[model samples]
Target: MTDCDFLLVGHGIAGATLADVLRARGHRVLVYDPGQANSASNVAAGLMNPVAGKRFALSWRAEELLPAAAAYYRALEQRYSQSFFTETPIFKIFGSPEEQNAVLARSADRPWGDFVASLTTTDPNLPGVHAPFGGAWLQHGGHVAVRELLAALAAEGHRAGWLRRESFDWTQVQFDSEGATYAGQVRSRHVICCEGAAAVRNPYFGWLPLTPNQGEVLDVECADLSPAQVLNRGAYVVPVGGGRFRVGATYRWPPFAPGITAVGREELAARLTVITDLPFAVVGQRAGVRPAVRDRRPLIGPHPTVPNLSFCGGYGSKGVMLAPRLATLLADWLVGEAEIWPEASVQRYNALQPAGVG
Candidate 1:
């Protein structure tokens, strides 16, 4: 009885962008992922930053979620031929002089001043790595090699049979009034729990207010740097293309533990030894968790008490630029067309709970 209309429970990146937006609206999802060994969009380095730094600001909805998440990952790399988004460009290295006068006072107050640029002291392309008080490019920041786009969208949803590698048995999930089913073999009318951070063990969305965080990364190789951008200073090297380099990220919170820790590899090798003494070659080390939400936004809707059980997740560090416009607004609010992001509704935490609490 493997019927389906939706069952997606975490294939990461918000259940592979809501199963490629409900299979491009033809609708008939099934996905049940147990992949990425406990996903955080698979130890993400899938950065899509649009201006973010200690106080450089401007990332929250960076201009309508960065060109609708780069035209939805270039239309899923032209309908699964596969490339996994690239666009790269993000230098941002300025150790001081108050971050080089905070990028000329944030480009004379344009806020993100058109993705900022022009501010250099010169490194003539990688001379011994560490730049002196100069760096600011950002131009359409990019990156998304999330494990080769979640292994090519879980091998094109298991060659279109719609995927189901295992582990999603909430007691074989069953709900009446003809809607949810699962182990009874997928009779789903709705049930989207893009369980990143395991939606805190979702019992109809474990009481909402999640704040998980746990990150940790490092995969150095750094073949003497080049114009391969994405290298913000205090942790964030990202280059990953042969000469390798996907350094860092360390953000623990609440007793989290996705593994890797020796105090997070000595706090990302002491922030990559303050920019670079050179000689790199770590190889690998990873960790997950990040389904953050402490007003960092992103929780999506439907399930104050389960109306077909919906929920995207708290996209902590901008899950690859807010999971394709909140998975096309949670597949247009599950087909009824629109309306949801009222600050990522979950009825805004049911209007701050209380009144007969639940």
Candidate 2:
């Protein structure tokens, strides 16, 4: 059997980042990626906003994740000789006077004041935009070119002999205290499943509350808008390139199919309507299933009952901002250099099954 220190399933952001971190620490990691259709990383807009929701509250652990993501992605850009991460500000349009007041209130708070600023009454000078109630500018964080980053990571994995571009069969895997053997063709000291929403089907990890979310995005050509920054109302518009902006992300639980639906498209269009008046043509549409959790926190670390088996998924909508930082933390924990963050540890779930039967 081909031997390695780690066997990674699902080469999405979580898996890709973890493999990168471990390899940097001098470990041999093999990644198995079936390349599933509608994987979240492939379809995500890659927007990283420090302030979230209408209340404009700071995102969970924003202080740590923001800098960590920026540094990690920047380093990857240097190593890969490709540009995928862009640091830009987000202009959050207030839908009502109440929302505008909320931003003002939050901005005066201690740490929140560090990243928030109220925009002047003057127009933002963007055509086809309506923000009568004004908006606020989030001074930190940005978006990543997720599709490009994933492709680069996959290339890096292949070049390093760490990536297997095929589906891994759980039924064919045999597990023991020492390690895991897959189809007798691969053996590893630890198996990390970064299967995203598909982990809900994994027998060993299905028991965890991996809530699958169906999200959709629209790729539209809007040259009249500024590509220098992102626009946010009820929805977000991210400038991808070539006068095309990526708009989207409607979250729906259940009916977790990857295909786009008429309802989803209509909802996204309506949300975009509130953000801009400039007419834009919808050039493309995309959708994927994100691995969300009830607590909205990521899952990391070894299984409570299974030896040499670990998990790293459930970054959900925040995968781009969360993956690189958590990946380093997980790698450190795996090599016995540190402990998994309490919120992300799998042990938080009291009902982890001994096997996937649940």
Candidate 3:
């Protein structure tokens, strides 16, 4: 007999979020985490914005995702008796007159009123920031303390005897007539891999088009910038607390190293300068690989042949807002309550791989 209902092979946002959902439904879940120091969830700023880019386009499924994220995190807070998610709006400064006009155009044509909370022009004399063309308030946007969420949720799981503080060995996982076996002892009815960018190293699901990108961000301490909201111009400045903000987030394809580079710092500093004239000191820096995919959609669902083995990853930068909603769906699917979304299902990529491989 299987020792548990589910064996979760990661402890990042994707796995942790799903575990919460499944456990709430009374499923037996065991999580194995290697405690990777540089996991993306550990280093992420955890910002969830509805509108983005120079044109201020609405993010994918913003209407549905924003509310779901807010509700889920709020529930998590009540469960943990801790505070983490903050509903801070984003003040996206316009770069140029043309860009300002572009936003106005988007607001008129698109239903931007739903996500673009407010829009206004700059006074030019505005202190600290260089917003001559003005900015907009992105509504229903906020940042989740991902590190806190992971830590708190892990603690909860550990207390409930569902969290294992160790790396999962894929070689030790065996699928047979009974179910999935791991470490030659523990047996599970199902195993879901949520290994983030590390999934690229997975032999079974590695065949998926996962483009792990290296992202670097700087934690800065600037007393002059606004802590009430996030500043998005050339780069983002998210308030971490008193006089400190998380900034930068350069995306480099084929990420080389785990350490922060001089080039990344310089590039971020250049953008930070454009955002404001106030001097700020870099208090800390972090780097991690985002589990992004070529299709830019989430990777989910069970293996084609091995029904007990599944995956839930490729969330990339939107893990905070995306994971919970997708996890709910996956949980429903696991219980035979619903089917997986086609776009995120592993079967969608089955044709590209050799027969029988997930």
Stretches of model 2 off by over 4 angstroms after superposition = 352-358
Per-residue accuracy of model 1 over 32-74 as CA lDDT, tens digit each:
8777664677788998888777777888768788999989898
Models ranked on lDDT:
3, 2, 1
Question: At residue 14, what lDDT does model 3 achieve?
Answer: 96
TM-scores vs. true structure, each candidate: 0.35, 0.96, 0.96
CA lDDT of each prediction against the hidden true structure: 0.79, 0.86, 0.86
| Between candidates 1 and 2, the lDDT winner | 2
Q: Regarding TM-score, does 1 or 2 come out ahead?
A: 2
lDDT of 3 by residue, 1-358 (tens): 4389989989999999999899889988888998887899998999998888886778777788889999999998988899889998888998888888889878754557888877887643445878888888887889999998899988777787789888888988889766688977898989999999999888788888888899999998889786888889877888988889999698988838667888888888889999888999988889888999887889899877765888999999989989889999999998889998897787888866666564
Query: Model 1: which ten-residue window has the lowest total lDDT?
Result: 349-358
Better of 1 and 3 by TM-score: 3
* lDDT for position 346 in model 2: 85
Give the CA lDDT, 0 to 100, for residue 196 in model 1.
Answer: 75
